[model samples]
Target: MKSARMLPVLVLAWALALGNILTVGIAVHAESPAAAGSLAAPESFGSISNPDQRSAAFFTELGKVLTHPRCTNCHPATDRPRQGDLRRLHEPPVSRGPDGFGLATMQCSSCHQETNFDPGRMPGHPLWHLAPAEMAWEGKTISQICAQIKDPKRNGGRSLADLIEHIGSDTLVGWAWAPGFGRQPAPGTQKEAGALVEAWVKTGAACP
Candidate 1:
């Protein structure tokens, strides 16, 4: 009689445990990172026989990363930088100030430290500031941005060769790949992006 009574309790306990497992599984899936996409290798475009066409194609591949929210958020057309994957304007209404950093009373480093704070969902780097106004990429076409990048006046005075180092190895640029919590990283690895830049330069840096 006691075992008969315990049978119902045991079955209820099993059902509760199963429900908990299912809930956890669903929660984990929901919180997982979204597909951030990928970039084609530079060699993959070798099939294009024309150098100009090949260079343009290479840059077009690199454009996948350049045009992503990760790159565009900091390169806002307006003085106010954006945040989040949705590319929303930053809260608290901070401006780019005379420098790329925020106004005197509200510097970016004040909230963003040297590393990401997952608890607060804030991303950081040692040099956390917006790109210069002239270099803003937001709302620009790939070809327009391409033209701007090749211009010393608009590209922070970087030469085509300088861009390779900046994109491939700069820690600040690398941060896009490792942006903390709730963010989709830019497409592909930095090295791949760098290789595309190199290939594009070698092929005459043609724009799409």
Candidate 2:
């Protein structure tokens, strides 16, 4: 009789567990792409009336990728770039030399080969090197980075069109999406980021 009495309790427990599992599954499916680490289309910010505000909104979304470690590790505020998701000081001690490559003793290509080596856990690309010192973005506000990106001298003479091409289709920039096994990729794909740049320039390239 006691065993019979406990049977209902056991059934109730399993029913509750099944209900919770279904709820979680439904929630996951409801999540948006931007919520799942991809950029949203510029038109999604439809509530804003001003074109400049809408432009700034687009860049703000792009900022998610720009400020990410994949982009920042190479855009060090100082000469010495940092690494890892934690943005810790780079191991093996390296710095931006006169031409954005390392010194003769510690060239970037010395360890970072043409392709990432998951076995050794080193991220690489054929053209990996620091951005110019003037483009250093670590510790700067999004507004500051935006201003620098618009200036020809700071942006390496890139016209708005050139900026779109560089960020949109450049193979080196595309690497941020495929950074090695242990690293977190930037928020969205490079193509998406470039599209945002193009939209921003078309709408006045306003800064946030």
Candidate 3:
């Protein structure tokens, strides 16, 4: 009699456990894509009525790419560039030489070349090198980065118009998206990032 009574309860418990697992699995599956990096389209922010607000909104979105490890690792606040997703200090302890390449003894071109070396998992581009120390983005807020970018003294003397070309057409900058295996790419496509830059500039390049 007791066993018969327990059977219904056990069945109910098993069914509830299975339902919970399925629900959790479904939720995870649905959320994973959003967790992966993405960028908002430039047109998506057009609904904002205020131009400055719209500009700032665009830049804030662009910040996702600017602040990603792929970008920041090479834009370390110090002379030493970082490497990898963890943003760890670079191995072999290389310093940015006078031209943004590493020290003469250990230049960036010493390893990085015109293309990725998948066997060694090293990323490369024909123009591989660190950003000038004046343009370092690590440890900066989006607004601070925006301000820095607008300042020619700190922005490699780039005008607002020049920024669009650099961000949109510069192959070296585009390399962030194509970093090889074992690396997380910057959010969104480079073209998308450049469109955001154009929109931001058109709307006044307001800082967030």
Candidate 4:
């Protein structure tokens, strides 16, 4: 009788031990950082021999970077530019004056200094100014922007070749990826984004 009672207790202890081992295994799997947040990583701009398909993929993925807060903030639809990740109305109610400069007395150069000044809460750039009306991306879908970009009338008369240099080496585009202090940088580094642009141009700059 004592042996029978001890057998039941032993089986229960074995089951508990198995459960603990399984729980620990699951925890180890969960805590591995590499396995977590895999979805948030940037997509690989893998090479493509097919000019058409490669061109399309490049622009499609590049769209994510271009349409981000940093690029779209200055390319707003209305005269008033938006700011921050929320894309809220520009503070202090500034407007894109006749020449894409600023309202009469409150020139963009007045507050947006040559360099970012965290003390003054100003985000700056060497040539800080609004994008031309043709480059406005606010209220535009990726498809629309892609189509417009391919049109000479809308793209500042630049050929596909021009886009490689325009996006890859342009100071303003580079600024989006490096805007300083408390500002969230754009999705990818400037060089990586520029390489993607170059690759897209080489593949013929297909619209997506």
Candidate 5:
């Protein structure tokens, strides 16, 4: 009897999760070159008349990008960075030391170069490093990310307005949209995701 009751909830959760995946897929398509000219991206959070619901949807959509391998690989819960779509342990082994850079002398920049196009080696960034401890997103859901993003303590002291700018224009965040070579880009372009962030912020930055 208990199993039957739990079944419905489990099924509902699965359905919701699948629906989220589909929604992200469609959203990516909508932002592609084919749909670019016709689609008016979200202007602001409050621009949606249904502020609360739109806020929810915006987070849901943004979650698709956040939960993707590109983002999660770096935001891993463990000290070690993950790799590939499989989310396996990084091959050579690495750890996010005190500075969130890497284990002492073995900094990430030692290998990853400024650009990726090459799969033979890890890519690099001028500031290539893991996110701060507070920003870990590896095991989190969209709702949890949303809540954390709104907290001054968790969000690196960023205000709601600051978040809009960061998500929309941050160079690092933009990189996910155009990760070259072997890596798969995040679901949507940074511009589109930024628009969603803007819309979510305007809609009172409601948490999921």
Candidate 6:
């Protein structure tokens, strides 16, 4: 009878101990550096008020995607494109041949097709090739990319309006969001990226 009575108290003590542990865990997480919040929303850029500052800030936000592996891989400073999130060099010794396509024997179209093939772990889009040599973004600062993106001579002759359209609606850019075979997608949706580009242009297209 005494043992049975002690069982209730023991069970109650364990429950209290578990509750305390959970409470401490939550408090620790709340205080931890790893618990920082996510990226600021696009609307938050409006808080800058200064058009130049806000515009530059907008591009900084869009920079999240522009610098991501999906975009940067093809925009390598060297002739070879990188692969995967690690930004490793292209395997099988590919190079950016004339017209940004591979050599006749090993064209990008030889592997990357119209869409991603999950079975092959190959990411594909109809336009899967290197950006022009002038448009190389690898090893450049976001500010540099920002400036180059706005320059007609460096940006493949695109006007600011053309840039807005390209970033805002280009299907090739959209492919960054749906990279297949278990790769990490870019920071946000392509539409969200486009909205940032549009906002950046509308405000002043300032470089960070």
Q: Judged by lDDT, which candidate is best?
A: 3
Regions of model 3 farther than 4 Å from truth: 1-37
**Top-down TM-score ranking:** 3, 1, 2, 6, 5, 4
- TM-score top scorer: 3
User: Residue-wise lDDT of candidate 4 within 1-208, one digit each (tens)?
Assistant: 9999899899999999999999999999877532343212223645555678767787777777678888889888878898887788998998888878897898899888888887765788878888878878888888788887777788778887777777778887788777777666777666666777777777777777
Quote the positional error of residue 50 for candidate 4 in Å. 4.4
Report how far off residue 2 is in candidate 5 (Å).
60
Model 4 TM-score (2 dp) = 0.74
* TM accuracy, model 1: 0.83
Report RMSD for candidate 1: 5.4
- Model 2 TM-score relative to the real fold: 0.83
Which lDDT value does model 4 have at 205? Answer: 74
Model 3 global lDDT (CA atoms, 0 to 1): 0.91
RMSD of each: 5.4, 4.0, 3.4, 8.3, 11.7, 5.7
**lDDT pick, better of 2 and 5:** 2
Q: Which tens-of-lDDT digit does each residue in 1-208 have in candidate 2?
A: 9999999999999999999999998787667332476787777878889999999999899888888898899899998988888899889999888888898889999999999999888989988899999888998889999999999899888898899999999999899899888887887788889889998999999999
The candidate with the higher TM-score, 3 or 6, is 3
> Can you write out model 6's per-residue Cα lDDT over 1-208, one digit (the tens) per residue?
9999999999999999999999999999987433433435679876787889888998998887888888899899999999988899999889899989888889999999999998988988998888999999997899999999999998889998898788778888778888987676777677777788888887889999
For model 1, how does the per-residue alpha-carbon lDDT over 1-208 read when each residue is reduced to its tens digit?
Answer: 9999999999999999999999999888776444444688998987899988999999888998898889999999999989988999999789998889888999999998999998889998999999999999999999998999999999899999999999889999999999999888998989999999999988899999
Better TM-score candidate (1, 5)? 1
Candidates 1 and 6, the one with greater TM-score: 1
